[model samples]
Target: MSQPLTGVKVLDFSTLLPGPLCSLLLAEAGAEVVKIERPRRGDEMRSYEPRLGEDSANFVLLNRGKRSIAIDLKAPDALERLMPLIREADVLIEQFRPAVMDRLGLGYAALSAANPRLVYCSITGFGQHGPRAQEAAHDLNYVAASGTLSLTAGSDGAPVLPPALIADIAGGTYPGLVNILLALRQRDQTGRGAHLDVAMADNLFTFQYWGLGNGALGQWPGTGTDLVTGGTPRYQIYRTADGAFLAAAPLEDKFWQRFTELVGLDAAALDAMPPPQATEAVRAAIARQTAAHWEQRFAGQDVCTCRVVGLEEARRDPHFGARGLFSRTVATATGERMAALPVPIDAAFRATDATLPSPALGADNPLLDH
Candidate 1:
């Protein structure tokens, strides 16, 4: 029971972030993942800057623990060659736009005929048969189209660009993995596979549940409007005297009382005041002290107030190390190593390999012959 997917075989036909990250999770859980890449250049991510040895750091991190098989799908013999692998693959993941796979003769209907039990997963920005299905899009575009960007306002009265790729990872990768696992489970009972169309834009509505409900009630929630959207002093960011930002979210009355008291504010007066005026008071109080001063005051306090640190400081946090978040490692072809990209999968499901190497172009091509 150490690794549940010990005998599962995954044929990864996607690249870049979402699809590769999804396959990485399966590979970590002992799935034999064979990454199908184009010949010569392989995944375009391999050429991205910030190289980690011969491959881009992104490619190395995302494709870790997977074997590579290079093939030119445009070749006349391509479908003939892929037939063997398709017949044996338990899962096939692709992120090409609608009908692109069908043109290449590798569509779900085509491949599922070869292996009736294949769980075919297709991740795209829209879907297989929508007006915007063929439109090219990135994470930002998806978020914008899904009404998420409208709520993320910045100080300049414009939407703030998210630091993380919410649409790619949360919208696409997670949903892709969940559906693939569910399809596999269903196959175990019915002995038939399914075609999963995971649309990143469509999946985004799930994260906007609160806003949707409020909108349905005609309140129309947005940045600086909803409670969680900084409508109240209780859930807002403040600038400290030392130029550090404190993300404070003491939404409950008890936490808000504690927070106001810690910052030397009259809790009753602030509560009686309008939200805008109350926010101004809290901001003024926080601006009177350095981040270090408040960090010390709020150290063990349950007021939900803390100084925000840069990415480097957050990465070096002792809490993550104590939890063995970076215990696993990824190695380069020349044997250099770095901490592997931490995945959300539980450690119990990971195989006992301390380090795994990302594949070189066509490293597992011989498997194509067998």
Candidate 2:
């Protein structure tokens, strides 16, 4: 099957996570992505720890199936060098702060003037015109500013650090991909492109919609007090006797009853107890057994409870293997290979032979000469 973005051309000027991830998704969907990097020193992510040949494992993982073109955008004739490619490009995604691209003469207005159908996307920590637009931030800061971090408090009421880069991938990357696709569709109708201002901080509010809705009606519970956050015994992580954890989320009454019964707890007693007391009782019951014991106990159960496996175990799990989630491998410049990072795009949209090694600096510059 042909990929949805089979013939689209993208010029990616993003670094690190958000914009690179967005372009990576597009590349997986069969877009021909040309990543524009600075001369000599490329994306900083290339220097991250756990090296794979010339670049870091992270760089190789995110940049597979894409071309690299090195150019110093700060140079006087950089815009002239990029004009030819921009004119032929379908999308241009950048992650610099507001006005940085404009100062370099490659902002949306300038690029769109040359290519009227170009989809120019800017992924930033905040929107271009926001009060915090120019403020430096990373994934954690963006989530903190968005009020989403406050909801991730631990039992002691301190905000827990997120296990993943939620703001970067969910807020910036996913939203940018969605809007860019939407802009492409819109361009097909109007014969004009658009400037997408993807604000990581702004997009995070969607994740808190339930909390926001509840808070609006003066039903605001304190941190870690919501049904999904730890207020109830039905949904939480419990430590086992072996110090490993099991995530229990039997939210529905029937599933909760099943879980309670399996743990040898009286369902009626838990029901009559207050939430804190019920939570304590559930915790005590789970602590009595090792994680392996609970894992075996819940193996074929309908209850929504499971042991928390580490990343290495998850990577080797039969379920993921059966689904072919890690079937793809990415090669480094030196021909070393590692498992390709997973993207959520359907397998149908990915070419079976799509894997390509991360490019050396200026490896594809000849394409720009034309």
TM, every model: 0.98, 0.98
lDDT of each: 0.92, 0.91
List the candidate 2 regions with Cα displacement exceeding 4 Å.
none
lDDT of 2 by residue, 37-78 (tens): 988888889999899999999999999988999999988888
Model 2 clashing-pair count: 0
RMSD values for the candidates in order, in angstroms, are: 1.0, 1.1
Locate the minimum summed-lDDT window of 10 residues in model 1: 330-339
lDDT of 1 at 56: 88
| Candidate 1 TM-score versus the reference | 0.98
lDDT of 1: 0.92
